[model samples]
Target chain A: MTVEKTKTRLNIGADPREFQKRPSWTNEDILALLDEEDGTLDPRIYTDEDLYRLEQERVFGRAWILLGHETHVPKPGDFLTTYMGEDPVILVRQKDKSLRVFLNQCPHRGMRICRTDGGNAKSFTCSYHGWAYDLGGNLINVPYESEAFCSDFNKSEWGPTHARVETYKGLVFANWDKNAPTLLEYLSDATYYMDHMLDRTPAGTEVIGGMQKWVIPCNWKFAAEQFCSDMYHAGTVSHLSGIEAGLPEGMELSDTKIPTVGYQFRAKWGGHGTGFYVGEPGMMLAIMGPKVTEYWTDSEAANRAEKHLGSAERARQLMVQHMTVFPTCSFLPGINTVRTWQPRGPHETEIWAFTVVDADAPEEVKEEYRRQTLRTFSAGGVFEQDDGENWVEIQSVLRGHQARKRRFNIQMGKGRSGVGNKDFPGSIGYVYNEEAARGLYRQWIRMMTEPSWETLGP
Target chain B: MIDEKMRAATRQGDISLEALSLQHEVEQFYYREALLLDRHEFNDWFDLLDEDIRYFMPIRTNRTRREQKKLEYTKDNEFAHFDDDLTMMRGRQRKLMSDVGWSENPASRTRHIVGNVLIEEELSASELSVVSSFIVYRNRLERQVDIFAGERLDVLRRAENELGFKIAKRTIHIDQSTILSNNLSLFF
Candidate 1:
């Protein structure tokens, strides 16, 4: 399908290492890393420095990355500094109350214009030089601009690069590729699953607290892929200790059962995916405790969500749902912990996590969400502790030469997936399946290789 | 427990023998508590905490200088590293002792170096507000090692039990905005 590539003023700065020559991997080499039909993946995808650099340009450069929630920048001049790939960008609220994302770097010497995590600011002045930028990222002042240069030196031409900003419900996203599809188009059928957490109430979702930042030594995709499709880990082993420890009073381990009846949704177009138990809140009860479980399933807020979503399955029964919107953004619906797996390097990921509750919910419910998410999913959370252990161990093992040569077995529920489910959208599969994982890699490959929006856009 | 009156009392000089004895007792309590934690004597360490204890660790943030006082650390009712009450702390203790807590399965060797103790307030005859700095060093499976440095604001209650004091409340202020460790599997 032919499509016109939209013009984007976002300037992805020149590669800082452009002077150095490095070993190259062709598109054919990148394509061979994942065997979609075979469901086997090369380990190098998680370790190679060169491949990681390419991903910064091809995958992260084009995809719409989740930066922050709208609640973070409620008033005009409010801004939050975040990363789109390795490149730092500032998500700022304009004077018109619209949002704009621009590179945090100063155009003069490539120093960051804003250093603080987030706060309201009239303009960002670079610490390196006296260059200043308006809320809209327009170059407003430069040190000795008129005196140091000729009359032809234009101040307007030297502003930091700007990214195309959009919001899906209350979540803000920024994209650098001008040719890429809009955020909604990029999200596609995945919005059905996303609305479970996001569009639950008419008042929409609000972040419960400030962002909790932590570092994990692992590939970013490991966290992304698991959130997209790895419910298998939760049921079989990873969270058993957490569940047993978090069991409600008067309840025994024998009373708790893992839910089997569920569906995994793999987006037909985008790489987004989510898996959830259909009728059981057993896992939810264990992880989020009884208060959050009751509020999520049987409370007035949940009833409103059921009416608002128009699907009982999504609002009430889809318990303990884990999801990823391609590349990096991930969240749990019932647990309500939204996060971005900010890729640091080939071997490390910086996680910025926060909890969100329906804005219209009572104070007690909101406080319950904050407390429960802290206990169950934050940096020191019970379930969260196990996840990082597995990832870090795997990453450590991959340091071996033989380990890098072996292929990962991702062939779970391969031929068992089908489209056009009656209740769910997208390609539906069993909850304990890796069909979504394959879909994630397939889209990753497509984004890595496809050069034009004519082929990549919807 | 630390009221304005108690805070004011802490600043006033009181070099009486009673004060010196109480100071030595509090320091000894901390050293023993650190030893119990380092020895993986979790249940013993658990006994050192009051049943109504509030163990908390706020998530630190990098904010502008003007906003630092209000926004540098997460608030009491907000997201934090460890916002555990007695029941939650019990759950964590239970998880650690269990076989399936993979993060600590092989069991990290930890040494909680606690020092710089100062009595911040004398809340009552039975309660005292104490502040101390600690450096917790953990060495996990193979080459994984982490060092966490933080200051703890604690309210210690004098008890009739053998331990002499119990931690009624503890608020840990870790130095880093972004935690360098993978997970806080071990306690501070």
Candidate 2:
């Protein structure tokens, strides 16, 4: 393939690209903080502003981030507004039935072109000025163009910057870097586990509800890391109270013991990770009531799902799993609370989450899933409250000078983690281990230091 | 059976002298509940609900004016911001009381403003449908203040006595499509 540098697209004074490259931290300083072999990390990685700025460029910029579900914009002219990293983006369904993701800022003055969260529109017109663009984000009109500007001014050259859009099993993803690997290649072996949520039924999945958005006073990585590798938190430190409270009436806490049989999968190359219990649905029973659990495990629905999924174990036994697709996207499989942790500076995160269910599932089953997620994972969710509290408290402590002086101990089952499991793929480990956490920071630092995908790959 | 009765009652909009009297009584009940919430009497507030109550808040969507007319909220059971039975509500209260429910540990101060009280209908001698508007302003710590405005559709049931009443069912419809607050830990 031949490559060519396109000319400057818009006439917004001194290029915004130059202004965005103003971070004052060096790669050496950041790399020194993350000791990959020893599984230790400096707290400064969570508290520094310059490091945060560099992360926006190195990590979020190159990664393939999830936009929304395909069913969210199923028809032509449908659109939804979301953020890729901190940049507000508009995901639109074009006339040809393909997807387009573009920066929401107008080229004329850098104001948002589409203001509302989402809608169907023939074209988007800037509310600040009268500049208009088609669903493809191609510039079509500028109010009073003949009288206000020179004849040499061209409308075709002033469209919003578009990202490379792709999909896997109905989930939409986009990347800003053209050189980055395809979404399939970037996903690597993580797809096997993602199928537990996205591809269980032949009819596929559809987003069940509107987005639930809320802000938390904590860094984005804290949330991402927890989802990727922290199933150990479920047994202690957090969620035990929630689990005990959610237990059935006739059963006592002593009768229901937390399951210890599970495996954690850290991706071979990318920072993706997932963990799930093997033969126990105890956590699922506590979080999602007996009705939903029965439907997910023993009902005819489970039979059909196992047939379509080609694994009885995955359909019936893989209960209450959590996963993260690196930099931002995170979700729980049985609970099905999918979210994007949009970073807002270093100390805050805006969580935009939604729920999905099999399109072919019974209405009652779908309703049960919805209700269960509302009680267990949303902003007011019981388990969600526990997880957010720890992150918020840790962030508050990171503001202290003494807190950043020591390195966090992430050495749980470090070298003892086995190579692979016969049933599961990727590098496997016991349920309670920090191997995935080490893999995450190792990938993070590599992305920050290396300039291209060729050097960053396994 | 209660779900069906509550659903039908909330859909009716009949007004009568007896209905207006019932409306007055229900309005007073709401005002008292608001005062209790503002004062942080959560345990006492818990007693105002029936043992089998269904408290729900459906997730709202931001559609164009035309699309808004189609359906402003998600389906009754499809997605809800808060869907609590009596047991779940009790659990929430228990968590808040414990020192671990950090969302409410440094508990937020809230003032629930209830207005536009309307007795939609009198479903039966023992059951009445009531609708009202509310704006809850919550302050946490020093610099955080969030205002949530919404409407409540409730089924108020008369207890054995003439003066006692309980909320059998409630459906809260938040105004903003996207909730701006950090969490919906505070009740409306």
Candidate 3:
């Protein structure tokens, strides 16, 4: 296949970093709110506007945010428009099979550079003012340039701000900070756990069923933290009813026991974390349906994955993994529902999500992956509704003054270290604990307060 | 195998009904189904489905007008909002009826405004292919209201001596790329 390369050339160009006025909150205020010692959290962290603004600048600005799967824009000149902390960005596949991510706003009047969600485009012309830009977001056309402006109105200088783009196993991520750690360095030890989803097969993964997006009234952190560490919710009533409904014919909820043997890996840096059962696939069975469960755990696919992933036991373990690659990227390994929690405001998050399946899997297996994800994890999914309800209700409650003033206890498994569990890397804890949540908040605080990657580096 | 043949024939609009009187019967059947849903009489609504029904609503993705040739949904047997056969549909009904289905504990008051019924074809003496458009207005509690508009292609089979029909298959094509509703907890 001939990849359609971009007509406009890409240079590192000028770095895109924001210089905002001093905010009302200080580093001390944020630190005091999150007491890492006792694991107490102020509710304002989910409700405060000033802190949210700081987060967009200090956290999302520097962090490597997962944009979309590379398959979404595999052909050159194919672009997917999405958001990075409320700033619209376009991820385009350039000629030479490289990717370019840039702000989607026009330099002329700040309208969107690409109006559609995803498509193959030679150039994107702003509908508002008719300003056209090449695939690399370089301003290539100005309507009636000779009649409208002087010779100094240089097209080369008016392009949209470009972000540093990187791809790890077909996942495209973009970062605005020029000095931040590379994507791999930022991923740290999280890659080992992430590989459970992306690197399970030699052909790797490709996106299926397109994007499923919806809005929820909740802080993005709530969704991120839950995916990072909250296995506690899974065992609760949040999923029990859905799991019960998905049980095999003639089998009751009491027919099987929910697995308790699982481990949560809190990242050493970057707030990335993952948790999964070692030898249980009950959740996988419930969410992904029977066809998918067989394909995922049966001999043929499992053996191939074991060889490629290089962990024979883990590959064949029938494990159901839940993971977050920091800030917003979260995915369920067996279910394969990958989503980004895009922060709309302090109290609203727009969930943009898609599912990925093994590229070389049988057509039927791929179809099952797509079908199962929609039925179990998409915007209208059974499990997704259970999760969203909790977040929405919590956000609604935080509207009260007293609710905003109370402290949320996060002291599950505090001081618990991975002393005995040598099987997994990083700080490990029981599945139903807040060890990863603490790690996430700790990293969030550090990122918000520290000015440079030098100070934030592990 | 016959369902595929029937669907292909229906899409081809190969109308074989000599008498168009059955069109009124099919329209009334759909209206009754809508009424059952609007009244939240789920078990009664469930009875309208054939035991081997394949009811589905596929997720539609956004595409430009120029890219209209590309399908909005995934390939056959791929992802969908619902891919329910009889047992799975029963499971959904059971969840909605349960007391702890949090998303629907206080069920959203729904109106499945099924209209534009067109009896497109006669697949067999017993089966008729029908097309219809619907606008479902759902309101939860005192606030959140979501409206979903879509078109449904259904395969209806003649039931016993009654003029009513049973829906053997329904493919609901929702118009919105991103569903504005929180959950598709209700049947379309």
Q: Which candidate's DockQ is highest?
A: 1
* Top-TM-score structure, candidate number: 1
Greater DockQ among 1 and 2 belongs to 1
Considering summed lDDT, which 10 consecutive residues are worst modelled in model 1 chain B? Answer: B1-10
Worst 10 residues of 2 chain A by lDDT: A1-10
Question: Residue A262: error of model 3 in Å?
Answer: 0.6
Collision pairs in model 3: A5-A95
lDDT string for model 2 (A240-267, tens) is 6677557665565568768889888888
lDDT of 2 by residue, B3-67 (tens): 34434434546354444455566777888889888898888888888988999988787666767
> In candidate 3 chain A, where is summed lDDT lowest over 10 consecutive residues?
A1-10
In the range B1-188, model 1's lDDT, one tens digit per residue, is 32443344466586655566667778899999999999999998988889999999998888899888978998976789888889888888878887888888989999999999998788876789899999999999998889999999999997876778899999999999988978988888
lDDT of 1 by residue, A369-408 (tens): 8888988897799889999999999999999855675678
Q: Write the per-residue lDDT of candidate 3 for residues B87-167, one digit (tens) a residue.
A: 777766666776767888787898888888876886786787789999999887558788889999999887863436788
Each candidate structure's TM-score, on Cα atoms with residue i matched to residue i, is: 0.94, 0.89, 0.90
What is the C-alpha DockQ of each candidate? 0.75, 0.46, 0.46
Query: Residue A104 lDDT in model 1?
Result: 91
Q: Identify the candidate with maximal lDDT.
A: 1
Q: What does candidate 3's lDDT look like per residue over A5-77, in tens digits?
A: 2222343333233124354877776777787786787878899898999999999998889899999888999
TM-score, chain A, candidate 2 = 0.93
Q: Name the regions of candidate 1 deviating beyond 4 angstroms.
A: A1-22, B1-11
